[model samples]
Target chain A: MPAELLDGTKTANEILGKIRSQVAVRVAGGGSKPTLATVLVGADPASITYTRMKRKRCESVGMRSLKVELPAETTTEQLLAEIEKLGNDPGVHGILLQHPCPPHIDERAAFEAIPTAKDVDGVTLGSFADMWFGLGGFDSCTPGGIMRLLRAYDLPLSGKRAVVIGRSAILGKPMAGLLLAADATVTICHSRTPDVAAAVREADVVVAAVGRAEFVKGDWIKPGAVVADAGYNAGNVGDVEHAAAAERAAWITPVPGGVGPMTIATLLEQTLVAAERDA
Target chain B: MPAELLDGTKTANEILGKIRSQVAVRVAGGGSKPTLATVLVGADPASITYTRMKRKRCESVGMRSLKVELPAETTTEQLLAEIEKLGNDPGVHGILLQHPCPPHIDERAAFEAIPTAKDVDGVTLGSFADMWFGLGGFDSCTPGGIMRLLRAYDLPLSGKRAVVIGRSAILGKPMAGLLLAADATVTICHSRTPDVAAAVREADVVVAAVGRAEFVKGDWIKPGAVVADAGYNAGNVGDVEHAAAAERAAWITPVPGGVGPMTIATLLEQTLVAAERDA
Candidate 1:
C-alpha cells in the first residue's frame, strides 16, 4: 500500500481560511487589526524572501505586517535595542525574527530580546522553557505544524514510542519535547548516536529532523509506523529516503508538499492566537 | 552478583572539601566571600531544615549566606520581587528558593524571577533551557548529583538506553535532558505512561524520581543495569523498592545515602562554581 501523504499545503489553507473569518469578526467589532512585526538582520536573500512571503500571507488574512530590516554589520547591542523597540510598541502583537543572523551576532540573545508575550516566533528562552516543561503557550512553528498534522490524522500519541532523529534547538529537540508532552516515549538521536537505524526500527512514530538528504533508508522504518519527514534538502529531498520509506510507512509526509507549507501556516495561526491573548 | 551501593554522603563530603579550599583561596586573595541566598516562604518545618542544612554547608566552605523569609500569606508579586532582588544582586552568586512555597503562590513565576546567571538552584527558565540544550552553566542540583554519582563510579552513559520514571520540572524531565545531552537514548515516563515496567526493563540505566516509595520493582531492571534512585519518601524509603532491585542491578543507590546528600552537595558545588565564574 502506498503511504498516505500528510498534505501540509491543503491543511495550511484550511487553517488560513479559519483565520480569515476570525480576523473579519475582530475587524467588524472595531478591534485593532492583528499586527506582526518582522525583524530581518542583514540582506540574506532567503531570509528576505521568507519575510516577504509571511507578510503577504498576513495581509491576505486581514492582519497587519510591520517589516524591519537591518544592516549586516549590526552589533548584538543594536539589534537587541531594535527588538526591544518592537516589543514595547503598542501596535505590535507578535514579533518574528528571521534567524541565522551574522555569526558574530548572538542570535539567542537577539531572540531573547523579544518580549515573551510578543514572541510570535516562539524563539525566546521563556517560550522554549514553556515548551520543554509542557506548561503550554507558543511552540516553534514547524514542530507545532507537525503536531497539528498528527492531531488532524486522529492518531493516538499517548503511550506510543516516538524516535526523533536530530537535536537542533529549533526543530528536533522541541519536537521531541512536544511528543513527550503528548505522553509518547521519546528517544532523541544525533550524529553521535551509534546506530540510528536500529532506533528507528523500533519506533511507532519516527520524526526525521536531521538535515542530511535522504539519510533515513526505507528499510529502517518499522512496518505500520507513522513517518514524519521534517527535513528539506536542497533539491526538495527529505531525511527519509522516500521510495523505500513509502513501502513501509502507514502514514508519511513528503518533504516539499508536507512539512514546508505547514510551517508558515502554524506561524500565522499562532500569531493570531497571540494577538487574541494580547487583546 | 550483588549490586554495589552508590554512596552519596561520602561523595558529597569529598566535593564539599574541594570547594572549601577554593573558597579559602578566594578569601585569601581579598575577594568577596561567595554567597548563596535562600528565599524561604513560610515556616514549613521540612523546608526550614533543608535551608538550614544548605546554609550550614555554605558556611563550612567559607561562603556567606543571605536568608530571606516571608510569611505564608505572601503574594505572588511579593515572592517574585524577592527572587528578582536576589537575581540582580551581585553579592548573591547563588539563589535557592525553597520549593513547595505556599500553595497559593505562583511557584513557576517565582522561579522565573531568578536570573539564569545566579540560578544555582537551576529552576528558572534560563537554566532549564541551558540544561536541556546542553550548553550548561548550571543544572538542577538533584540531577547534577545523580550525574556526579554515575561519573564517580565510571558508569558509561553515552549511547546507553536510559529510562527516567517521573516527569517533574525539577527532577525527572531534567534528568532525561541531562542523559540525552550525555548521548544516551533517553525515555521520560510519567504517571500517564503505560507499560512503565516494560520500558524500565529495557533500560541500561533507570532513574526513579516518582516520589512514591518502592515504586520501581526488581523485575523492571535489566540484568547488570545501573540505577539511580532520587526519591526520599517518608521514614527513609526511596522510589525504587530496594531489596529485590539490589539482586538484579549491577549498581544501585541506597535510599537515605544514595541521592539525598549528593543533591545538597551538588547545590554547594554549583554555588561555588557560579561564584568562581563571577570572579
Candidate 2:
C-alpha cells in the first residue's frame, strides 16, 4: 500500500481559517486590520509571482498589504532604508522581503535591517537564534510550515532519528534546529555529505530540502519513515522520489500540494500573530 | 597502547602565546590595550573563580579586565542595566557575563543585552546565528575551544560523522553547529535521545557535553573514533569514561586539562579580536 499522504493544502487551509477568524475578532473589537508590507527588489518573475500570491492571500483573509517594488539595481543601503521604513510604519504589523533580491544586494544586511518585532517572514538573525534555542519567536516560513505539518499529522518527533538534507539558512538549517528542539536526534546533511543515502537509511524522519529533484532515492528511506520533501525543482519535481518513497515510507508529503502551500500559509499565520502583538 | 591524549593545556598555551604577541604588536603600534568587562550577578564560588581565571588570562595577554560584581539578589533589569553600561563604555571591547546568574535572574535576557560586537563570549543571539550560519562570528567559548582542538589535532571534519551529546546553548548546540559548518554530518543527542549509545557507536567523532560523569561508556565509542569530553562533572570527572574509552578510541580529551583551559583561552583570544575590530 502507498504511504499516507500528509496533505499540506488541507492543513494550510485549516490554519488560514483560524487566522482569518482571529483577524475578524480583532477587527470586530475595533482594531485595525492586520497589515503586511512586502518589499521586492528587482523584477524576478518568480519573486514577483510569490509576492503577488502572498498579497492576494492577505487580502483574501481581510488583511492589508503594503507593496514596495524596487528596481533591479537597488543598492543594499537603499533596500535597508526601505525595510527600515516598513519596520517603523505604525500601520505595518509584519514585514516580508521577497528573497533572491538581485545578486548584487547584501541580502544578509537587508535581513538584519528588518526589526525583530516585524520580522514575520523570520529572516532576521534574531529570529534564527530564537528558533535554534527554542525561544519564543517567529520561525522561517518553510521550516515553521514543516513543523506544523508534522504536528497536524501527529508524527512523533521526540527521540526519532531525523536527517535534514540541505544546509540552506531558511530551510535545512532551521529544520534541523526545530527537530532538535522537538527532542529528535537531528543530523544535517548537504552536498558535501559523503553518503546522503546512508544517512537517510538511518533516519526515522527524512526532510529533503536539497533543491535537487529526486535526489533522495526511495530505497534509501528507512521503512516506516516520515518523509517531508521541502524542495521544488523544475517541472514540479520534489527532492524525494515520491512514488518510490511512498511505497516504503509510512507517511510522505506531495511536491506541489505539500510544503509550498504550507510556506505561504505559515507566513500569513505569523503575520496575524505579529498583528496581534503590534496592532 | 591507549588513545592519544588531545592535550588542551598545550594547545591553549600555544594560542595564548600567539595572542600575546598580537596584543604586543597592537600596543606597540599605539593602540590602547583591549579590555574585557566581566559581569557577575552573584558571588557563586565557581562563577567567581571562572571570572578570575578569565581576568588573569586577559592580563597575561596584555589586555585589561574590568570586573563588575553584583549582589545575588540583583534583578534582571539591574543586570541588564549593568550590561548596558559596559556595552556603551568606550574602553570595553568585549563583555562576558558569568553564567548561573542566580535562579531569579533572567539569564537569557541579560545575555541578549550585550551588544553583538562586544559579545566575545558569544552569548548573544546575533553571535549564535552568525556561528550557526558560518557567517564569521565569535563562537561560544567551550565550543570554539573544542573546534580549535579538533583543528589542532588535524582531524578531518569534512564528511565525518560527529555525534554531540547534550544541547546546552553554550556547549552542545554550538558544538554541533561548528561541526556542521566544518562539513561534518553532525547529530545532536540529548537526555531525550532514546539510544544515545547507538548514535555514539556510529560516530567518527563523539563530543560528550551532557554534564554527567562517565555517562558515555567506553563500549559506546566506535573503535578509532575521536572522543571529546566537554563535560566537567563533580570531582573533575568527564562525561566519557576516559579509561574505558581510551582502550578503544584513537583520541580522547582528559577531564581537567582538556576542554577547561581551552575555554578561557578562546574567550581571551576572542576579546582581542573584538578589540581589533571595535577599538
Candidate 3:
C-alpha cells in the first residue's frame, strides 16, 4: 500500500484559524496587541518574499508586525544593537531575524542577542534548552510545525526510534531534541555520519532536514516509517524522493504541499502563542 | 585482541601535575590567586564529599577554594542569589553548584544564575551552546573528563559514530553535544530507548552515563569500539560491566580507576584555563 501524505497545508491552516480567533478575542477585550518584529538584513529577493509571507500571516491572525530593514553593509555590532533594542522593547512580543544575513555578519551572535522570552523563533540556546528539556515556551517554527503535523496525524512518538538528518541549529538539532523529549530514542546524523541510510532505516520516525534534494533514498526507509522531509530544495524537490518513498513510508509529507506552508504557519502560530503570554 | 584499558587516573594526575606548575607560575607573578567557589545546599553526604574533593583539588593546585553551605529548606531565590553573589565576586574564577541540591530547588534556574565565564563546571546554557555549536569553552566536568581521556589516548572523534546513554543536562546531554561538536554522529539513548543494545553495538565510540550499573551489556559492544564508562555506580561497578566489556571493546575506561579521577582533574584544568583567560 502507498504511504499516506501528512498534508501540512491543511494542518497549518487549522492551527492558524485557532490563532486568528484568539487574536480576535484579545482585540475585542482591548488588551495590549500581540506583535512580532522581524529584522531583515539586505534585500535578498527570496528573504524578502519569505518575510512578506510571515508579515501577511501575522496580519491575517490580527497580530501586529514590525519590520526592520538594514542595509547590506550593516556591521555586526549595529545588527546586534538593533536586535537588543527590539529585545528590550515593551511592545515586541516575539522577535524573528531573517536568516542568511550578509556574509560578514555574525549571525549566531545576532541570534543569541535576542532575549529568550522574545525568542519566539526558538533559535537561541535558551529556547533549545527549554524545548529539549520539555519545559516549554517557544520552539523553532519548523520543528514545532513538524511536531504539530505529527500529533495531528495521531502518531505516537513515545518509545519510537527517530533519526534526524542534519544538525543545523535551526532545524536538525532542535528536531532531535524535540523528538527525544517526546520519549523517542533519537539519533542525529549529518555530513560526518558514516551511513545516513542505515541510520534512517532503523528509525520508526525519520526526519530529513538536510538541504539536498532526495538525499534519503526509498530503500533506506523502514516499511512503516513516519517520514518528515523538512527540506524544500530547488525545483520543489524534498529531501526524500516522493514517488519512491511514497511506496515505502507508512506516512510521508510531500514537498510543496508538506513542510513549506507549515513552516510559515508554525511561525505565525508561535507568534500568537508568544503574544498570548504578553496579553 | 582484547581492549586496552584507557587509564583515566594516570592521565588525570598527569594533567593535574601540569596545572600545579602553571598555578605556581601565576603565583610567582604576584597575581591574585585563582579561586573556585563551591555552593552546597543541605548536606547530602555525597554532595559534601564532592565539594570537599573539589576544594581539596583547588587547594592542591594553588587555587583558593570558597565553600558556602545553605540549609536544606532554602528557597530557590535564596540559592540563586548566593550564586549571583559569587558570580559578581572578583575573587571567584569558578563556581560549582554540587548536584542534587535539595529536590525542591530549581536546579536549572540556579545554574543559570552563574555567569557563563565563571561556570567552570559548564552547567549554564552558554556552556551547552558552546558545546553544541563547536565553539571552544568550558564543558561539564564528567564529559570534559571523558573527552580529555579520549584525546589522551589519541582517539579520533571526527566522523566517528558516538552513542551516549543518559540525557541529564549536566552529563549525557552535554556529552552528546561535545561529541557532536567534534563532528561525531552522536546518538543519545536513555531509559526511553527501546533498543539500547542495538544502539551501543553500532557505535564507533560508546559513552555510558546512565547511572544503572552494568546496564550496557558486554555483548552489545562493537569490537574495536572506544568505550568510556562515565557511570561510577556503587560498589565501584561502572555502568558497563567492566570485565565483560573490556573483552569486547578495542579501548575501554575502567570504573573507579577510570572516569572518577578525570572529573576532578578536568575541573582543575578548566579552572586554570579560565584563570589564564581572566589573567
Candidate 4:
C-alpha cells in the first residue's frame, strides 16, 4: 500500500486559518495587529524569496509585516543595531533575520541581538536553549512545523527511535531536541556519520533536514517508518529520495508541500503568539 | 582481558595540580585569587557534602570560596536577588547555584539569575546555547569533566557511534552536545527509551548517566566499546554494571573515582578561567 501523505500544505493552511480568525478577533476587540519584522541582509536570492513568502503569509493572515532591507556590505554591528531596534519597536512582535547573512558578518552576534521576547523566528541561542531544555520559547520555524505535522497526524513519539539527519542550529539540532522532549530516543547523524544508511534503518521516525537533494537513500528507510523531509533543494527535491521512501514509509511528507509552507505558517503563528503575550 | 580503567581520580589530581600552580603564579603577579560563590538553597545533605568538597578544592588551589547558605523556605525572588548581588560583586569570579532547590523555588529562574560570565556550573540556558552552537562559553561541569577525561586518554571521537543513557540538563544533554560538536554520531536514550539494551549494543561508546544503580547491563556493552559511567548512586554503585562490562570493554571509568572527582576539577578549572577572563 502507498504511504499516507503527511500533507503539510493542508495542515499549514489549517493552522493559518485559525491564526487568521484569531487575528481578526483580536483586532475586532481593539487589539493591535500582530507584526513580524524581517531583516534581509545581502542579495541572497533564496533568502529574498523566503522573506517575500513570509511577508505574504502575514498579509493573508491579517497581520502586519515589516521588511528591513540592508545592503550586502552591512556590518555585523549595523545588523545587530537594526535587530535591536526592531526588538524595541512596539509594532514589531516578532523578529526574523534571514539566515546565511554575508559570510563576513558575525551571524551569531546578529541573531543574539534579537530580544528573547521578539525572537519568534527562534534563531537566538536563548530560543534554542529554551527549546532544548523545554523552558518555553518560540521554536525555529522548520522544526516547529515538523512537530506540528507529526502531531496533526497523531504519530506516536514516546519511546520511539527517531533519526535526525544534519545538526544545523535551526533545523537538525532543534528537531532532535523537540523529539527528545517528546520522549523519542533521537540519534543525530551528519556529515561525520560513517554509516548513515544503517542509522536510518533503525529509526521509527526519520527527518531529512540536510539540504542535499536525495541525500537519504530510499532503501535505508525502514518499513512502517514516518518520514518528514524538511529539505527543499534547487530542483524542488528534498533530502530523501521520495519515491522509494514513500513506498516503505508508513507516512511521508511531500517535498514542496511538506516542510516549506509549514515553516512560514509556524513563523506567523509564533508571531501572533508573541503579540498576544506582549498584549 | 578486563578493560583499562579511565582513572578519573588521577586525571583530576593532575588537572588540580596544574590549577594550583597557576593560582600561585597569578597571585604572585599581583592578581586577586579567583573566588567561586556557591549559593546553597536548603540543606540537602548531599549538597552540603558536595559544597564542602568544592570549598576544599578551592582552598587547595589558593582560590576563595564563599558559601551562601539560604533557608529551605527561601523564596525564588530572594535567591535571585542574592545571586544578582553576587554577580555584581567584584570579588566573585564564578557562581554555582547548587542543584535541587527546595520545591517552593523556581529553580530555572534561579539558575537564569546567574550572569553568563559567572555561570561556571553551566546551568543557564545561555551557556547551553553557546555550547550547542559551538560558540565559547562555560560547559556544564560534569560534561566538561567528561570531555577532559576523553582527551586525556586520547580517545578518538570523530565519526564514532556513541550512546548517552540519560537526558538530564547538566549531564546527558550537554554531554550529547559536546560529542556532537566533536563530530560523533550521538544517540540520547533515557528512561522512556524502549529497548535501551538494544541501543547500547550497537555503540562504539556508551555513557551511562541515568543515576540508577546498574541500570545499564554488562552484556549490552559491545566488545571494544569505551564506557563512561556518570551515574553515582547509593552504595558506591554506578549506572553501569561494571564487572560484566569491564570484561568485554576496551576502556571504562570506575564508579567512585570516575566522573565524581573530575566534576569538581572541571568546576575549579572553569572558575579560574572565568576569573582570568574577568581580570
Candidate 5:
C-alpha cells in the first residue's frame, strides 16, 4: 500500500491555532504576554531566514519576538554575554540562539549559557538529559516536532523498534532520546555504522536526519514503517528518497511540508509554554 | 572457539595501581591528599556495602574518603543542603551520593546537587550529556568501567553494532551513549522492547544490564559477539546465562570479577582526576 502522508503542514497549523487561542486567553485575563527572544550571532543567510520565520510564527501566535543580531566576528564570551542578557530579562520567557554561529564562535559554550528556564530551543545538555529521562523539559526543536507529528498521526511507539540515522546533538541524538522516552527500542545509526540498511529493515520507525539528500534509500525502509525525514538539503530534498520511501512506508513526511514547518511551530509552542510558566 | 574472558578484576587492579602511583606522586610533590566525599542518605544494605567497597578502594589507592550518613527521614532540601556543603569545601575533590536514596527523598534533585566539578560519579545530567557529546566530562561508573574493559581488550568498537539491554539512568542509558560516542551503532533495549532477544541476536556486542538474572539467554548471543554482563543480581548471578553465552561469544566479562570491580575502580580513578583538575 502506498504510504499515507503525515501532514506536518496541517498539524503545525493546528498547533499554531492552539497557541494563538491560548495567547488571546492570557491577554484577556491580563496575564503577561508570551515572548520568544532570538539571538543571531552571525549573518549567515540561512540562519537569518530561519530566525525571521521563527519570529513571524511568534507574531502569528500573538506572542512578542525579540531579535538580537551580532556581527560575524563576535567572540564566544561576547555571545554568551548576549544570551545571558536575554536570560535575565524579566519579560523574555524563552531564548533561542539561531543555529550555526560563525565558525570562530564557541557555539556549545553559548548554548550552555542560556538558562534552563528560558531555554525554549532546548539546546542545553540539561534539557537533553531531561528529555532522555522523561522529566518535563523543553525538547530540541526538530526532534520535538518529529515526536509531535508522530503523535498527531497516532503512530504506535511503545515497544516498537525505532531506527534514527545521524547523531547530531540537536537533531539525531535528541530524536533517539525522545523515541526512547516514548518506550521505543531505538537504534542510532550514523556514518560509522556498518549496516544501516539492515538496521532500517528491522525498524518499525525510521528517522532520516543525516543531512545527506536521499542518503536513506527507500527499499531499506521496512514495509509499513513510519518515516520522518528531518534533513533539509538544497533543492528541496530530504535525507530519504521520498517517492520510493512513500511507496513502502505506512506514513512518511514530505521534505518541504513535513519537518520543516514543525520546527518553527514547536519553537513557538515551547516559547508560549515558557511564558506561561514564567507567569 | 570459546570466548576469552575480559578480566575485570585484573584490569581494575591495574587501574587502581595507576591511581595509587598518581596519588603518591602528588603527595610527594607536597600536594594535599585527594579526597572523595560520599553521602549516604539511608542505610540500605546494598548502598552501605557499595559505599564501603568504594571507600575502601579509595583508601587502597592512598586517597582520603569521607562517608556522610544522613538519616533515612532526610528531606530533599536537607540533603541538598548537605551536598551543597560538601560541594563548597575546597578540600573535597570529588563527591558521590550513594545510589538509591530513600524513596521519599527526591533522587534526581539530590544527584543534581552534586556540583559538576566534583561529580566523579557522573550521575548528574550534565555529565551524562557530556559523555554523549564526548565533551571530556566524567563517565558514569559502570559504563565507564565497561568502556575501559573494551579498550583494554583491544576489542573492535567503531562500526560495530552494540545492544545494551536496560535503560536505567546509571547503567543502560549511559552504556548506549558511551558506545555511540565510541563510534558504535548502539541500540538500547528495555522492558518495553518486545524482542530483546532478537535485538541481541544481531548485536556485534551485547551488554546485559537489565538487572534480571539470566534474563538474556545464551541462544540470543550472536556468534563471535563480545558480551559485557553489567547486571549483578542476587546470589552472584548476572543478567546473562554465563556458561551458555561464554561458549559462543568471542569475549565476555564474568560476573563477580567483571564489571563489579571496574565500577569502584573507575570511581576512584575519576576522583583522582577531579583532584588533579582541581590542582
Candidate 6:
C-alpha cells in the first residue's frame, strides 16, 4: 500500500481553528488581542509572499499584525535598530524577522536583537538553546510544526533512529535537537556527510530540510519509515521524491499543503503563546 | 604497538605559561587583571575541592579570584541575587557556579542569571547557541578542553563519524557541537540510547562523557580510532576501558592527566579572553 499522507493542510486548519477559539476566549475576557510584528528587509518576491501569508494568517486568527517593510539596500545596523524598536514596543507581543535578509547584512546579529520574551519566531540564540535543552522555549516554526505533525499522527519517536538531512540553523539543526530531546537517536547529515543514503536507509524517521528538489531519493528510505519533507523548492518540489518515497514509506508529507501551511500556523500559535505569557 | 597518549598535563602547563606571559603584557600595558568569581551554594566536599582548584588555577595565572560561599539551605532566588551581583560588578570578568547546588535549588535558573559577557564557564544558553553556531563565544570548559586536545594532537575531524556517549550540557552536547562545527558527522547518545555499543562501534571518534566507569567497552571502539574519555568516575576510572581501548585505538587520553587538567586550563583561558573583551 502507498504511504498515508500526513495531510499538513488539514492539521494546520485544525490548529488554526483552536487558535481562533482561544483568541475569542481571551478577547471575551477583556484581554487585549495578541499582536505579531513582522520585519521584511528586502523585496525578494518569495519573502514578500511569505510575509503576506503570515500577516494574513494573523488576521484570520483575529490577531493584530504590525508589518515593517524595508528597502533592499538596508544596512545591517539599520535592520538591527528596527528590530530593537519592535522588541521594545509595548504593543508587540511577538516579533518575526522574515528570513533571507539581503546579502551583506549580518542576519545573526539581527536575530539576536529580538529578546527571548518576544521572540515568537524562535530565531534568537537563547531560543535555540532552550529548544535544544528541552526547556520549553519557542522553537523555529517549521521544525516546531513538524513536531506537532508527528504528535498529531501519534508517531512514536522515542528510541527511534532519525536522520536529519541538512544542518541549517532554522530547520535541520533544531530538528535534530528536537528529535534528540524526544529520545530519538539522531544523526545529522549535510553536504559534507560521506554517506547520506546509508544514513537514511538506517533511519526510522527521515527529515529532509535540504532545500533541494527531490534530493532524498526513494530507495534511501527504509520501508514503513516516517518521512517529513520540509523543503519548499522553487517549483513546488519537496526535498523528498514524494511519489516514489510514498511507495516505500508508511507516512509522508506532501509539498504544497504539507509543511508550508504548518509553518505559518505554528507562527501564529507561538505568537498567541507569547501574548498569553505577556498577559 | 599501543596508541599514543594525549598528554593533557603537558598541554595545560603550556597553556598556563602562555596565559601568564599574556597577563604580564596586559598588566604592563596598564590593563586591569582578569577576575573570576566562583559561587558555591552548598558545602559538598567534591564541589569544594573543584572550586578550590579553579581558584588556585586563577591565582597561579595572575588572575584575581572572588569566592562566594552559601549555606545548603540557600534558596534559588538568593543564589540568583548573588549571581546578579557578580554579573553587574565591573571587577568580575568571569563567573563560575559550581554545579550540584543542593537538590532544592533551581540550578538552571542560577546559571542563567550570569550575564553572557561574564559567562566564562560557558554555562549560559547564549554560549551554547554561540558554540553550536560556530560564532566565536566562550565554550563550556570540559568540551573546550577536549577541542583543544583534539587540535593539539592535529587530529583531522572533517568527514569523520564521532559518537558522543552522553548529553550533559557542559560536556557531551557541546562536544558534539564543536565536533560538528569542525565538519565531523556527530551523533549524541545518552542513557536512553538503545544501543550505545553499536553507536561506538561505528564512530571514527568516540567521546565518552557518561559518568560511568568503563561504560564504553574496548571491543566497541573501531580499531585505529581516536578515543577521548571524559568521565572521571570514582577510583580514577574513565568511561572507556582505557587500557583495553588504548590497545586498539590509534590515540587515547589517560584518565588522571587527560581531560581533567584541560578543563581548568580552558576556564582560565576563557577568563582571560573575557577580561580582554571587558578592557
True contacts kept of each: 0.62, 0.91, 0.75, 1.00, 1.00, 0.69
| lDDT for A39 (candidate 6) | 95
Give lDDT tens digits, candidate 2, residues B1-279: 689999999999999999999999999999989999999887789989989989998999899999999999989999899999999998999999999889999899999999989999998888888888888889999999999998999989999999999999898888988998999999999989999998999999999999989999999989999999998989989999999999999999998999998999999999999999975
Angstrom error at residue B219, model 5:
1.0
Best-to-worst ranking by lDDT: 4, 5, 2, 6, 3, 1
lDDT of 5 at A195: 84
| Whole-model lDDT values for every prediction | 0.88, 0.92, 0.89, 0.94, 0.93, 0.92
Give the alpha carbon lDDT tens digit for every residue of A158-211 in model 3: 989899999999999889888988988888999988789889889999999999
Supply every candidate's count of residue pairs whose N, Cα or C atoms clash at under 3 angstroms. 0, 0, 0, 0, 0, 0
| Each prediction's TM-score versus the true structure | 0.93, 0.98, 0.98, 0.99, 0.99, 0.97
lDDT of 6 at B209: 94
lDDT value for candidate 2? 0.92
Q: Write the per-residue lDDT of candidate 5 for residues B1-279, one digit (tens) a residue.
A: 788999999999999999999999999999989999989987899899888988888998999999899999999999999999999999999999997888898999999999998999999998999999999999999999999999999998999999999999999988889999999999999999988989999999999998899999998899999999998898999999999999989999998999999988999999999999999
**Poorest 10 consecutive residues of model 2 chain A by lDDT?**
A270-279
lDDT of 2 by residue, A1-279 (tens): 789998999999999899889889999999999999999999999999999999999998899999999999899999998888888888999999999889999999999898888899888888988998888789999999999999998999999999999999888888888899999999999988889998899999999998889999999988899999999999999999999999999999998999988999999999888888875
Q: Candidate 1, overall lDDT? A: 0.88
DockQ, Cα level, model 2: 0.88
| TM-score of decoy 1 | 0.93
Candidate 4: regions farther than 4 A off: none
Chain B TM-scores across candidates: 0.98, 0.99, 0.98, 0.99, 0.99, 0.99
DockQ in order = 0.63, 0.88, 0.75, 0.95, 0.95, 0.76
Alpha carbon lDDT at B87, candidate 1: 80
Candidate 4 lDDT, B1-279, residue by residue in tens: 999999999999999999999999999999999999988988999999989889988889899999999999999999999999999999999999998899899999999999999999988888988888788899999988988999999999999999999999999999999999999999999989989999999999899999999999999999999999998999999999999999999999999999889999999999999999998
Scored by lDDT, the top model is: 4
